[model samples]
Target: MSLVPDILLTGAGAFILVSLVIVFRVVRGPTMQDRVIAVNAIGTNIVVVLALVAAATGNRAALDIAIVYALLNFLMSIAISKFTVERGGVL
Candidate 1:
């Protein structure tokens, strides 16, 4: 049992914990913005996990996916904001 694997596993566990918290917020928050924030946080955490897994496994494809995810997150956020404003602030 090396410390490296333990550290990696700990990182993953932390990701899971944060993801759970975000999910809870997304599900129970009274405001749409709160849910959006939680969703964005989840996307960020997913990108981080993708990068970590890529580094640990020496997989190049994971890095590409992470990059795509990052771009998609940004685009989605922008689109959502525009839609919200156009919809007169309703979700």
Candidate 2:
């Protein structure tokens, strides 16, 4: 077995573990902000996983998708902030 595959597998495993923890927080969080944070974390982890998978499979389209995901994440954050402000900081 090569070290590259081993490293990739380890990285993927770690990303999954962290994603599960974020999932737990998203499910059991007491506050909306906590859940939002978890969701954002999940998105970030998804991007990371996709990038790794793209690298492993030698597919460049995955990189494009990852970039789009990052942009979406940024847009979501901005929209959330705008919504919260419009809602008088209650959201």
Candidate 3:
């Protein structure tokens, strides 16, 4: 049997903590822009977590999935921002 390295696990744990804290901002942001940025931050955090997991497990496929999710996250943020701007940019 094998164990994942401690540092990778620790880094992933830290990012998870940060994502959890950002969830509050997503839930109660005063404006649409704030919420969008928070959501984007969460998305980025998850990708980092996924990459860390992949490294710890020696599975490259998960890293590819993380990259794909990151691209989607970027596109989604742009789309939502555009939609909000078109509607006068407020929640």
Considering every candidate listed, which one attains the maximal lDDT? 3
Ranking by TM-score: 3, 1, 2
After superposition, candidate 2 runs with Cα above 4 Å error: none
TM-score of each: 0.86, 0.82, 0.90
The deviation in Å at residue 5 for candidate 2 is: 3.5
Which candidate would rank higher by lDDT, 1 or 2? 1
Model 2, poorest ten-residue lDDT window? 1-10
All candidates in order of lDDT, best leading = 3, 1, 2
Off by over 4 Å in 3: 1-4
Best by TM-score: 3
Compose the digit string of candidate 1's lDDT tens values, residues 6-90.
5765796699788987899999988777778888889998898888777666689988999999999988888887777798887
Of models 2 and 3, which has the larger TM-score?
Answer: 3
Question: What is candidate 2's CA lDDT for residue 75?
Answer: 87
Question: What TM value does model 3 have?
Answer: 0.90
